[model samples]
Target: MLVRLALAALSLHAVTAAPAPQGATTWYAVSTTPQGDTVSPPTHWYAVDTSSTTTPSSRTTSSSTVASSTSSSASSSSSSAPASSTAIVSSKKGVGYNDEYLTRELAISWAYNWKSRRGGELSEGVTYEPMLWGRNATGWATDAQLGLDEGASALLHLNEPDIWSQSAMNVTEGIDSWLTNMSPFYGKTNLVSAAVSNSPEAANLRWLQYFFGNCTQCEQETHAVALHWYSDSFNTSAFKTWFTDAYELLQKPIWITEFGVQRFTSSSNVTQKQEFLEDVIPWMEAQPFIERYAAFGTFPGRFVNDDGSLTALGRTYSETV
Candidate 1:
C-alpha cells in the first residue's frame, strides 16, 4: 500500500549505528526536530557500559526538551509524577504503539511515557507502562510482578473490555476480576480502570453504574480512569461532548491513553487530524481533571511517522509541549 511506503520513508530519519551485541546495553540520545519529531544524528549522545545481566527498570528524567530515561516493562502504566521533572517516571505525555517496530528511540523518542505489549528496553528519560490483556490472570500476575520489581508508579488495568476484540468482559466479571487481582495493588500503585471502548455502548454512566453497584472494594481502591477516544467528526464539539459526558459521571482524573480524530483509512484526512489536535490539545492541557494523555500512534496520518518524524498532526499535537 501507498501508506506503508510513506511510513517506510518516514523511518529513514533514524540514525545508523552499529547494533549492540546480544544482551549488551547500548545508549542513544533521541533528538527531536524543531517540530518535535524524532530525527537522526542525535543532538547529544552518551553511553555507559552496562552488564548483560542488569535487570532492566523504568525511570524518566528530563532537562528542558530532553527526557533522560532507562527502560523496562512494556506499555501501559500510570503515574501522577510531574512532566517536567527529570528524575521521575510520569504519564503526562505518553504514546501507545509497537515498541518493537517503532521503538522508543524511533517513534516516541522525545515522549515521557510509552507502552507496547510486553516489557522491553527504552531510551533514556522515557517511562514504560505494562498493560493487562483481557481476563488473563496469568498476564496480570506477570505485569504485577514487574510493577512491584520496577517500583512502577501506576498500573493500567484491562484493555477495552467493552469491545469484543479486546478484553470483552461483562460487568460482573470485570468487577470481580478487578477485586481479586487488581485491588491488592491499590495502595502499592495507582490502579487505572480498564479503558472502555470509544462508543456510546460503552457509555460512561452505564458502565460506572455496573461497576460501582457490584464492586464496592474497587470503588475506593481504584485511583484513576483510563479512556480511549476516536471520533468520525473532527471538531471541538465532538471531542468536548464525549469527554464532558464522561467527566460528569466519573468525577475523577482522566488519562486518555489512546486518542485520534479518526482511524487511518485515508491520507487525505491529515488536515482533519491537525484541526482536531489544534482544538483538543489546548483544551485537554488546560483541564485540571486531565492527568495525562497520549495520541493514538506515530504512523502516517496519525501524530507522527513510523520513524518518529512529525507529520502535520504531530506538529499540532506538540505545539504546547
Candidate 2:
C-alpha cells in the first residue's frame, strides 16, 4: 500500500529536486540545559548538511558557539522529559530518502543501495519506512522485496483518500492482502498515515478518516499519526492548537515527522527561525504524549546556499534541538 501526498504536485521535475553536494551536512545535535529551562546562548555549534556534504571532513563536531547571558531565568513549572519509547533508532547513521528526490525508479534504486550498504539487512531494532506515492504496484513490490532483504518495518503514505473511491475497493483489498502476506518476512506490517492538505482544504480530514476507516488492517495496525506542520504558515499558537487537537482526536502517538521554516526565501530572518524552534522545542518536549520531532531537511544541501554554510534556521535547529 503506497501512501502519498495527494496535494503535492507529482511531475517528474517536481519530485526529483537536484541533489545537494556530496559533502553537505543536514543534522546536528545539541545538549539540553541542566535545569531544563530555556536554551542557553553561545549556541554557535554547526555541522555540514550530511545529505549534501559528502566530504570526509564534514563529520560531526562539537565546535562553535554564540555568546549570550548565562543568568538563570527561573520558572516554577517542571520541564518535560524526552519520550521513552520510539521506533528503534536506525543503526545506519545518516539521512534517509529525500522527499524532494522521490520517484518510483529512484525509490527502487535507493532501496537497493540502502539495503546493500547497511549489510544487506535492516538494523536489529531500527525500522525503515519510506514514503510511497500513488497506487504504485511496482513500488510496493520493491518495498516488500527490500523488507525481505533488510528486515525493516514500513509506513505507507496515503496522500489522498478521496480519490480512492468505493469502486476501487477490490484493488485496495488486493493491495492489503499482499501487504499482509509480506508482513511476516518484513518483521511488522506497514501502517498508513495520511497527509493533511493545506488548512483551507477542510475536506482532507474527512478523506483521511474515510480512508483509514475503510482499511480494517490499517486501522488496527497503525501506531502513530504523522504530520508535516510547516512553521512558515503556522505561528506558535496555531501549532499548539493543532497539536492539542491531534492529541485529543487521534489517541495514537503523534510524530511531527517533517517540519521547518524556510529562511532562505522569506523576509523572516534566521533569528526568527531560531527563536521559533527555541520556543517550540520546550513546548513539544513538555507534551507527554508526543513522540519524536524531526526537523525537515537537516541536510545543508537541501536548504543551505552554495558556500557550504548553515541557513539561519538550520543553525538554530542544530543549536536548539
Candidate 3:
C-alpha cells in the first residue's frame, strides 16, 4: 500500500538545504562491478557527501509524500495489505553475500545476493530478500515475478541509481521502469525503493524525493526505503550524519542493502574493516528505524576466506549482536 507515503506525511518545519562543507565532499565510492559485466567497468563514481542537511528542494520531500503521484487504479493494490508470513522472523542483522551456502557458516539471520533466486538450499528461517538490480539488469521484471511467486517477503528495487556505475537511472527512468517492471508486485510483497547511493552531493535523497513526488503509485507502493553507504576509512561521525539525513527526509524504515569501508579500494586493513564493522553493526542494531542491513560481502573485502571460512572482520560482524 501507500504506507511509505503515508508514513511520510509527517513534515519537517520550514527548512532549507545547508551549504556543502569540505570534509563531506572529499570522498567517493566506486560501485563494485558485478563479474558478469561483459566489458570493462565504467569510470568510478565519486559522491560528494554534502553536510547532512535535509534541505527542502522543489517537492523533493520525504520518500513517502506528495499528494499528486498516482491514479485511482493504484488504490486497488494499495487497498490490500502486503502478503504477510511467519517464515521471516524479524532480525536487524543479515549477511550480504554472493555465495549463499557460505552464509550457512555465519548464518546470523538473513542473506541476499544481487539476483532474485534465493541461492540454493539456504538455511531455514534465514530470510532471503531478493533484489531487482536495475533496468540494465535484463529480465529483472521476470525475475522479480518469480521471487514473488516463490514467496519472497521483501523485494528490493533499483540498486545505487544515484551512482553512474551501479544501477544508473534518473528519477523519471527509475519511475517508469519500476511501474512497468516492479509495480505489479506492489502489494504482493514488501517493496523497497530507489536504493539511492550515498552520493555526497545529497543526490540519493534528492533522487528519492523526486521519485516520490512524480510517481505517486510507485511511491505509494514502496514499503521501505533502501540506502547504501561507503567511506574510505571508518569514520563513524560521517556514517551517522549520512544515515540521519536520509531518515530525516524519508521518515520510513530503512534497509541498508550495501555498506563497507574502502568502498572501491583495497587499502582497508582487516582491522580497520573490523573496527568499521564493530562500530556500525551495534549502532545499526540500536537504531529502531533501521529495519535491516546487509554489508557488501565477498568482494572488495574478504568476508569469507578462499577456504569458505569467516575472516576476522566477517567473524566480528557475524558473531556480534
Best by TM-score: 3
Best by lDDT: 3
Estimate candidate 3's alpha-carbon lDDT, on a 0 to 1 scale.
0.60
lDDT of 2 at 109: 10
Judged by lDDT against the true structure, how good is candidate 2? 0.38
lDDT of each: 0.52, 0.38, 0.60
Deviation in angstroms for 238 in model 3?
1.7
**Evaluation by TM-score, superior candidate among 1 and 2:** 1
* Model 1: per-residue Cα lDDT at residue 26: 36
- Model 1 bad stretches (over 4 Å): 1-91, 103-120, 203-205, 306-308
* Residue 206, candidate 1: alpha-carbon lDDT: 45
Poorly placed runs, candidate 2 (over 4 Å): 1-128, 144-153, 160-192, 231-234, 261-267, 298-303, 307-309
| Model 2: per-residue Cα lDDT over 1-321, one tens digit each | 121222122111011133422343332222212111111222332222224222221112111210011012111221221132121221111123233332121101112111112223322333455444433444455665675366544444443222221011222433364354333333455453544432321233433344344555554566555554543443778877766665555555555554555332343465666677678866765565455455544233333334434455544443442
Ranking by lDDT: 3, 1, 2
Q: Candidate 1 versus the native: TM-score?
A: 0.65
The residue-by-residue lDDT of candidate 1 on 1-321, one tens digit each, is 001213322321133364433444334222112211211222323222233222222222222211111112213223323342222233356666544334432322223122223445555545556666556576566666675566456677766555433454556667878887887777777777877645543333345445655566776776667877765667678776676556555655677887765444256777766667767866765555566677756454455565655566555554433
Give TM-scores for every candidate, taking all chains together and pairing residue i with residue i.
Answer: 0.65, 0.50, 0.70
